[model samples]
Target chain A: MQYPEPIARLIDSYMKLPGIGEKSATRLAFYTLGMSDADVDNFAKSLRAVKRDLHYCSVCGNITEDDPCPICKDKTRDQSRVLVVERSRDIMAMERMKEYHGLYHVLHGTISPSEGTGPQDINLESLLKRLEAHKEIQEVIVATNASLDGETTAQYLAHLIKPAGIKVTRLAHGLSAGADIDYTDEVTLFRAVQGRTEM
Target chain B: MQYPEPIARLIDSYMKLPGIGEKSATRLAFYTLGMSDADVDNFAKSLRAVKRDLHYCSVCGNITEDDPCPICKDKTRDQSRVLVVERSRDIMAMERMKEYHGLYHVLHGTISPSEGTGPQDINLESLLKRLEAHKEIQEVIVATNASLDGETTAQYLAHLIKPAGIKVTRLAHGLSAGADIDYTDEVTLFRAVQGRTEM
Candidate 1:
């Protein structure tokens, strides 16, 4: 026998999430049924609240309930150096390292000419406007991944910032991760060898 | 900074589902935020509807929207034999095989002494009463899995039903398809040898 129509519908709702398939969705729906009545009600209420309350930060484009966001408004952080990244999740990763004390600028996405994504498509205009308005800024670190798209975007940003007499630096490359020499990609292998240091 | 209070609450709600940890819950919350408003509303509506509409079938204890359920009401199926199963999913599996034409009785669960589940814990009394009230019933097939708990429940049923002057049988077993003798577990290998037949 199949689930009741509503149960099936709830299962379908769960299946919309990333990595959750039909079987997992059904399991999740049954699990929900076992939850307390208040918990289920709270779950449904939370779904609605996230969509209603959360918004993008106006200055950095990070997810926030406030327009300027906590990082952008913080007076203690270094305003001279801004780390440019692609998404809010990247901000989380950076925060976990506890290495960077500068403010951030989220480009939201990279330029992919084939996919109709250009500099105009993302929040680059805001970065330019921020740089123009904030004269104290000295360095802009392009902290994007070393993928082709990230490199292209970083190069494009460097070209734009270099004309403004601001220093632009790319993240350094080193031995990557759990990778065997035989299995490593050619580009990564070449980079590793080129950037190798003598002890 | 972390998500806003409302968004964090929403993420926490998604975390309550089975197999969903904190990070996955946050990902799902973001995915939901990306969904269209209509889809989000439909998802919430379906959850409420499932709770409101679902009922247990009076005859077999399987979940159903109606009292006796479609399977129990179908006159074309063999009413004299009942395939007693552990859950509704088992009924779906049997139906997919297209070999079983008899009716079904869902016990909802098996007797597990460790879990404080005994014969009275499941719908065993209802099943016995159904068997006693129906004179046309000639055989009962115990189609529970071959797990230790399933075996224990099957043995318990065999003792209960043999004195009622009714025939009872279990699904035959030897070796599973696509299993190698070298890789098969010792118990399964022993059963395979014990049940071997001459060609």
Candidate 2:
């Protein structure tokens, strides 16, 4: 039996989100139906607001209500050190730790040849321009994921920045905290041994 | 660091959805931010439309754009039999089977006293009224779940409908099809033995 038009439409919209399947979309649609009109309006408004109000930060490529984003505009953050990440969401992760007080450069995505995403496709051009314009910036920390594409992007960024006489570094790879040594994957174990810290 | 107002609000709305946690909400919010304007507008509109357009069918409690609902209006269905279910979603499950061509009565919820949900809180009044108004309904099938509240609701519905001199039936409880005997719970195995068929 066919669902009502509105419910079907809602389910289809929900299915477009990442990781949500048919069953989950149906469940979410029903849940949305059960919500109060005010709550539903708020939810809908939030969805529109995210798209309508936000834009890419001019300086860093992160999403922001303002042009430069709060992080980029803040003068107190270390201007000499720049942490380059694959997406704006990764910036949130780093911010949550509260340990890093440096500026950020969002790549939006990594260089993936299989996906046909090259250096020209992502936010790499702006990073190079920013580096060229800001000679005081001494170090660029490449904090992309441990995946092949992420490594390729980091290496590519290093190659581009090293000639400009700026230090380019990638995040260290090791076994994660609370990980069991016996169950750790070979790559992580190998990295942990290779990058062993001095006690 | 706090997320931008729009992003934070979007994440908060996503978190309100069932089965979505903080991490998933963050992921969904970022995904929403990345969506094209038209796609975002469609998502937002769908949410609003589901709540604004859909209403309960007057004949049955199932959700629909029409007052009587398509199922209730369909003349080909067996009007003499009414299958009672806990929610509108359950009606979809029954419809998917393509076997039951009877009318439906959605209670919207069960008689759970601990949750302060009594018969008066649900759509039972309309069911009784419908039964009284239409004498042609030969059987009232109490297809509530097999949980404590579901059983209580089924028994209560049976008691209410039996005095009208109509047939009242509950769904059979037994081992599910393709269930492993070794892994089967004792209650299900016992029920399967007790409800054994002659065939």
In every candidate, how many clashes are there?
0, 0
Top DockQ model? 2
- TM-score of B-chain for each predicted structure, in order: 0.91, 0.96
Tell me how each candidate scores on DockQ against the true complex.
0.54, 0.84
Model 1 C-alpha lDDT versus the unseen true structure: 0.83
lDDT (10s digit) by residue, model 2, range B1-199: 8889999998989999999999999999999887888888998899999988999998999999988899999999899999999999999999999999999999999999889899999999999999999999999999999899999999999988999999999899998889998999998899899999999
Docking class of 1: medium
For residues A126-170, what per-residue lDDT tens digits would candidate 1 score against the true structure?
Answer: 999989999889999998878777888999999999999988987
User: Which residue pairs in candidate 1 have backbone atoms (N, alpha carbon, C) closer than 3 angstroms, thus clashing?
Assistant: none
Off by over 4 Å in 2: none
Model 2: lDDT equals 0.93
Report lDDT (Cα) of residue B35, candidate 1.
83
Which pairs of residues collide in model 2? none
